[model samples]
Target: MTTKMREEIDEIPAAAARLLDTQTDLIRDCANALKKADPKTVVTIARGSSDHAAYFLKYAVELQLGLPVASLGPSLASIYEAPLKLGHAAAFAVSQSGASPDIVAMARGARAGGATTISLVNTIASPLAETADFAVDIMAGPEIAVAATKSFVNSIVAGLAIIAAWSEDKALVQAVDALPEHLQSALALDWSALLEPLREAESLYMLGRGPALAIAAEAALKCKETCELHAEAYSSAEVLHGPVSIVGRDFPVVAFAARDRAEASVAQTISKLAAGNAACFITSDKATGGEKLPFIATGHPITDALALIVPYYGFIESLSRARGFNPDKPVALKKVTETQ
Candidate 1:
C-alpha cells in the first residue's frame, strides 16, 4: 500500500496547477487590494511549514518590491495580549487548515491594527480566512498526510501569484505562468543521493541562502517529522560562524542552492564544508567538492528554490519507510496544530 505521505507528495504538481488555474480570481482580488494599499512594509504570520512559506515570500518581496518583510510572532496576540501599530503595512497569514487559534488571533489583530490583511489558506471557510480582508483559497485539496507536502507548495505558489500581480512585473508573471510545467518536471527528480548519508545518520544540517534558506528550513523540519532525525537549517554564512565546528566526518550536510544571486556563495560554502570531510551534497553545479544533486531551473529565482522541495519530499517519505516508520502518521504529530 502506498503511504499517504507519498500519495500527497505525488499530488504536489497537480495541486500547484489547480491553485494557478482555479484561484486566479481570488489571487487577482488580493493582489489588487495590496496594490491599492501600497504598504511600506509587509508582515507575515504563520507557524511550522506555513512559517517556512512566509520566509520564502520574505525574500521575494524584498527582492521584487524593494520593501522589507518581517515575520510577526503570533504570541504577541495569542499569549501576551499585546497589539501592534500596523497602519501602513500589509500582513499575509498562511495556514493549511486556517483553523489555528494563534494564526487567527494575529491575523485579526493585524486587521484591527489597520493592516490590509490577506490569508492564503487551504480551507477557505476557516477562521483565519474570515478574519482577513482578502482570503485566497490555495486549492491544495484535502491533504491526508500528517506532514504537509502539497499545501506547503500551494501556499508558496499562491503568494508568488499575488506578488507577480501586485508588482506588475512581466518577468515574474511569466515565471508564475510557467511554474505548473516546471513543478511537474520536479516531481520526477530522484534525490535518493541523500539516502546513503542520511539513512543511518542521527543528525544533519541543511544549508541555503536567500529564498533557498526557507526551503532548507522546510527540508529540515520534514526530516525531523518523517525520518525522526535531528536536523538544523542555517544560512550559508551563519553556519561557518559557529555550526561548522560541530561538523565532522560523520556529519551530513545538504546545501540547497538555487539559480539566484546567492547560488555561488551557497555553493562555495558547501565546498568548504565538504573540504572538512563532512558528507556534503549540493543542488547546484557550482560546488566543486560536494556531490551535485539534480535541480530543475524554473527560470526564476523564487521558483528555482521552491522547486527543490518536491524531490526532497519524495526522498524523505521513502526514507521514513526504510527506517521502519510511517511518514503519514509521524509519532506524536497531528495534521492541524491548534496552538493558542
Candidate 2:
C-alpha cells in the first residue's frame, strides 16, 4: 500500500505548479506592498515544518535583497501579551493549517505594530489569512499525512515567488518558474544509499550551509518525526567546531551541498569527516572524499537547495516503514498543534 506520505510527496510538483499558476495575483500584490513599504527589515512567524520553511525564506530574502530577516517568537502575543515595535518592518506569517493560536496571534500583533503582514497559508479560510494585509493560498491541496510534505514545499515556493517578484530578479523568477519540473526530477532521485546505515545507527548528523542548512534542519526533523531516528542538523562549519569530537568510525553524516558558494565549503567539511572514518555522503559532484549522492541542480542556488528536500521526503517515509512505524500517524502527534 502506498503511504499517505508517499502520495503527498508525489504531489509536490503539482502543488508548486498550482500555487504558481493560481496565486500569481496574490503573490504580486504582496510583492508590490513590500516594494511600497520598503521596509528596513523582515520578520517571520511560524512553528514546526512551517518554521523550517520560514528559515529557508530568511536566507533567500537576505541573500537576494540584502535585508536582514528575523524570526519573531509568537509567545510575545499569545503567552506574554508583549507589544511589538515593527513599524518599519514586514512580517511574513506561514502556516499550513493557519489555525495555530500563537501564529495567528502573532500575525495580528504584527499588524497592530504597523508592519505590512503577508500570510502564505494552505487554508484560505484560516484566521491567519483573514488577519493579514495580503494573503496567498499556497494551493498544496489537502494533506492527510501527519508529517507535512507538499504543504511544506508549497509554503517555501510561495515565499520564494514573493521574493523573486519583490526584487524583480529575472534569474530568480526564471528559477521559480522552472521549479515544478525540477521538483519532478528531484522525486525520481535515489537516496537508498542512506537507508542501511541509518537503519541500525543510534544517531546521525545532517550538514549543509546557507539555504541548504534549512534543508538539513527539515531533514533532521523528519528523521525524528517520521522515522523515529535521532538526527541533528548543523552548519558544515559549525559541526567541526565541537560536534566532530564524537564522530568516530562509521558515524553516518549526510551533507546537503547545493550548487552555490557554500558547496565547496560543505564538501570540504564532508571530506574532513570522511577522513576521520565517518561514513559521509554529500549531494554535490564536487565532493572529494565522501560518497556522492545524486541531486538535481535547479540552476539557481536557492532552488537547487529547495530541490534537495523532495528526494529526502521520499527517503524518510520509506525509512519510517522499514523501521516498523507508520509515517502518516507519528506517535503522539496531531495535524494541528494549537500552542498558546
Query: Tens-digit lDDT track for model 2 on 1-340?
Result: 9999999999999999999999898889989999999999999999999999999999999999999999999999999999999999999999999999999999999999999999989999999999999989999999999999899999999999999999999999999999999999999999999889888887899999999999999999999999888989999999989999998775799999999999999999999888888998999987778788999989999999999999999999999999999999999799989999
Alpha-carbon runs more than 4 Å astray in model 1: none
CA lDDT of every candidate: 0.93, 0.95
Provide the lDDT at 65 for model 1. Answer: 96
lDDT of 2 at 169: 100
Q: How close is every model to the real structure, measured as TM-score?
A: 0.99, 0.99
Residue 37 lDDT in candidate 2: 98
lDDT of 1 by residue, 7-115 (tens): 8888888888888899888888988998889999999999999999999999989999999899999989999989899999999999999999999999999999999
Model 2 stretches astray by more than 4 angstroms: none
Please name the candidate that would achieve the greatest lDDT relative to the true structure.
2
User: RMSD for each model, in Å, please?
Assistant: 0.7, 0.7
